[model samples]
Target: MNIKITGTGSYIPNEIQKNEDFNNHQFFNENGSKIEYSNDVIINKFKKITGIEERRYASAQQNTSDLAFLSAQKAIDNANIDPETLDYIIVAHNFGDVDMNTSQADTVPSLAARVKHKLKIENPYCVAYDLLFGCPGWIEGVIHAQSFIKSNMAKRCLVIGAETLSRVVDKHDRDSMIYSDGAGASIIETTKDTGGIISTISASYTLDESNFLFFGKTYNKASNDEKKYIKMHGRKIYEFALNYVPKAMKACLDRTRFDISDVKKILIHQANEKMDEAIVNRFYGLYNEEVPEGIMPMSIQKLGNSSVATIPTLYDLILKQKIDNHQIHKGDILLFASVGAGMNINAFLYQF
Candidate 1:
């Protein structure tokens, strides 16, 4: 069964946080005590480590579901598909707008119900929900939608990746510098269409259990969990990317029976530049230097880390910025891979 994406869309918060913003605030609290730290210290540390100068963040009023809804609506309209006909809707990521509901509860049902009210398809097979291993959730969602459509279980499915990292960010901690907020959407159908999800490959390293890098949310909300900040094991993730990326790339290439040279572009997981450079250097040693010229790494030195949204966000940016100059022809191979919070990793070779 061939699954294809009919349309794509994305959304970021309206608010932008600059380096100076951090310079003005302290990221932690002493729980009825006192502390000495400001955003300036964190900002400088972020520059030294990730090289990011600014990032966008959702406001207290906004949530992940809002971003998902915005992007999903655009993708649905762009596809020219009626929401009433949609058989499934997949919500990825760990955040949402509604505070009391599950991510999907706050997300899928609300979006689908809105569509029903607007598009008139009050019922479409079923409104199923579950979590993907994340990092890999969007691809997994596309594949799942394809299976459903092919099986006659549904006709259309919308997959979303949304995160309010800022909501969970421990501003007092330097590790929080690695996360931001955003969302993305993709419309998938069970057809041999010109654009959509293609083959996907996932692999992991069990030996490096310590490479979890960092935990996303703490039960105590950072103030109690090591100063309420995101603590990242940078060197560990960096090393893991260097050692695992090449092997993972080879595995995907092998699965598709395509050589590395056959790939036109590689949309790598937005690892920081240092990690990218080191991994690419190691990639050359393991294989040839044919990883393509414009390897899309979304860590643009200032966007911070957007978790799941980074991959598709980069794809959208590339589409908008370079499509006129470098037209994406039929069957152009677009390779994508991402390594996220749980030590999860995935590679999807998309044919546009």
Candidate 2:
């Protein structure tokens, strides 16, 4: 038996936050000093590096779990499967249900439990839970599903990646522009089909890279509030990803004994466009081959980085023909890779 993704779905928010919207806002450095550059200069430099001119934000009424539920519902419908038959409901996210007005994350009944409740899966045996593996959480959730199915613990599983980063962002920091909100989900199950998951690789670098991304106070040092917000060492993350992500992808592809040319598409986390391009270039260089044109599809240009939701969202969009010039066909080899907080990295090879 092989494990395969039977259905995919995603919920792109309706609210659009453009870069020009931040022009009036004040941005500050982490050192408590005001940024010297004009807003246009800062945003222009940001676009040049990250390729994000706009991003989606969840409406005030929506929480992380709500986004997960919406995406999960679409996946279930797309699969045309009964919710009761699902053996597992795994929700992957960093921040839980963050309210619109506060930074406190509500994870009391786990996001998975909340999603299962929202899905109304009355079967108590469905075993709903949540996974927090940083931006790679969704991929990690799928990996866990594969493990459970292979171990006879589950037959059909629903993996969802969702986040409300806009709610947790520090408005005073320029890095806040990199965050948005969205969710994506997929139904994975055992199948008699020929192509499925071929190989997977995962690693965590915590000795010195642990705090590359973390929760910290806002950049405005004048604020005496004790509330913390999402923060990261952007340069550190870029350098770390460049050094490690390519090797992880190559290692995953190598395990399948497939040539680099066989990879039809790469769905990487939409962290930064230039960084992703460099990583893919180095990945191809490992095999002494030039990067193929259009081999990687991106949603970051409009979606920004929705943390764990990035890869799955990109995959869902491509599969649904929502992303132009990118399509997935049967017998095509695909690589999925991600790197994020926890200083974690993971990659998996899948054949469609």
Candidate 3:
């Protein structure tokens, strides 16, 4: 039996946070020194590098799990499957459900359990849990689902990538501008179909790169309040991704014994536009070929980096014909890849 993604869905929050919104805000360096550049200058440079002009933010009433449930429901409806038949519910996220009023993350009940409860799937046999594998969490969840189906442990599974980065960001840090909130989900199951997952690869560089992305105090050193928010060494991550992501992608593709020209579209994590372009270029460089036009579809220009949600969300949008000039058809070969916080990297080859 082939493991396949039967249906997909995404939930992009309604509130839009524009770059101009940061004009009046104070920005600081990691060392607590005030940024010398004007807000306009900084924002312009940010736009050029990350390709993000605006991003979505969840409303006060919505948490990460709520967003996950909304997306999961849509996926179920899209697949036209009975919720009670699901054998597993896997939710991937870095921070748990973070309230709008507090910085604390709540995971007393796993996000998957919460989603299962919300979906009202009463089957006790439906195992539910959460996975935290950085931005690649969603893809990792899919890998796990595939393993379960192949091992005869499960027949149907729901995997979701959801995050409320806005609630976990340090407003004083400029990097916070790179983050947004959203969720994406998919229904994966055994199928007799022709195309599905082809090959997958995953790796972690924890020795020196462990702290490339981590939680730290605000950039404002004067503030005595002890609170930690998501932080990262942007330069370090950029270098790490460029050096390793391409190799991982090529390795995954090599395993499938497929030529590089066979890939139709690459759905990479929308972390940084420049970084992603570099990774793709390098991947092609490995084969001594020029990068093809439209080989990749990007949502970062409008979505920012929603961590685990980027790839699946992009997939949902393209499948629904929401992205202009980009479409996926049967027999098309697609490459999905991501690099994020754990200093982690992963890629999967899929045939649609």
Candidate 4:
């Protein structure tokens, strides 16, 4: 049985924060109260170096689950599937709502319940849950969903990739200057004779080696609005993206019983344009160094890095702008790859 994606949807913050915002004023750490800057000198310097004009920010009012729910609804509507027909829902993210009953421990049930109630999904029961491993979370959602359908545990599922990176971005640091908030969802409905994710490969290295780029908290159950922010070894992360992406991509291609030539197009986690270029360049023998435009960049210059949501958001963009032109034909192959906080790298081959 092939689990195929029938629809796609995404939601980004309504507000846009420009380069000037950082240059205009100084911000203090919510806990330490340490100031980041005294003036606009450094912000301009960053503008010249990174070429980022603006980025998105989620309001203090919105939480990760709220964004995930909206994206799921959009995907459901796009698929035109009766909300009642979905057997399960998976919301992927590093953050979750702050409720004792919100969602935790096991993601499969609590997440399903949250989406079922919030969307008013009627008739059929929905199994909701979360996947918290990090950026690899989204592709893992697809692999996990496929297994459920294979075992007859579910007939149809909605796999969501959601992120609120803006909530954790360290505005004080210029290394991670590009970051924003967004949510994306892809409809994965079960069918024995169709196209979908055909292969998925995951590999994790030592955490101590890759925890160089990460965010931590003052307390275990830290508030998102607290002094919560990201910390990173920028140089280290850039190196990881370059090193891990090709290995994972090749491993996925191998699992799917195909080569780079078998892939019509590739979708990668969009950490930055520089990193995207590095990976794309390596496939010169496979793709001729010619990655079709609008696919690789992920339009991240404006959206920044949306974490788990980045690849799905890029997929949505690909569908909206190019599906009708070159097209995802019957039996076509698609690939998804990512590396996140846990230092895990994952790749998947989709037939669509």
TM-score of each: 0.80, 0.99, 0.99, 0.82
Pairs that collide, model 4: 107-129, 107-130, 111-128, 111-129, 112-127, 112-128, 112-129, 196-351
lDDT of 1 at 233: 62
Off by over 4 Å in 4: 25-51, 98-112, 122-125, 217-226, 283-297, 322-331
Tens-place lDDT per residue, model 1, 1-352, is 4677777877767787777766655454324222454556656766766667777787777666677778777788878887767777777674444342122224455543443343345664647464445465665566577667778887788887767777655555555666778777878876656645556777655566443654444323434544232346676777777778767766776787666666777766554756665665566556656445565445445556677676666666566563334445578787777776566667777778
Candidate rank order under lDDT: 3, 2, 4, 1
Candidate 4, run of 10 with poorest lDDT:
98-107
Give per-residue lDDT, candidate 3, residue 325: 95
Model 3 lowest lDDT segment of ten = 220-229
Q: Candidate 4's residue-wise lDDT over 5-123, tens digit each?
A: 88888887788988777764444443545455654656666555445667776777876677778888888888898888888888888765433222222333455467677888775
Better of 1 and 3 by TM-score: 3
After superposition, the stretches of candidate 3 with alpha carbons farther than 4 Å from their true spots are none
| lDDT, each prediction | 0.63, 0.95, 0.95, 0.70
| lDDT at residue 12 of model 2 (Cα atoms) | 93
lDDT tens digits, residue span 1-352, model 3: 6889999999999999999999988999989999999999999999999999999999999999999999999999999999999999999999999999577989989999999999998999999999999999999999999999989999999999999999989888999999999999999999999989999999999999999999999999988858889999999899999999999999999998789999999999999999999999999999999999999999999999999999999999999999999999999999999999888999999999
Q: What lDDT score is found at residue 331 in candidate 4?
A: 81
Give the lowest summed-lDDT range of ten residues in model 2: 218-227
- Candidate 4 at residue 15, lDDT? 82
RMSD (CA, Å), each prediction: 4.7, 0.7, 0.7, 5.0
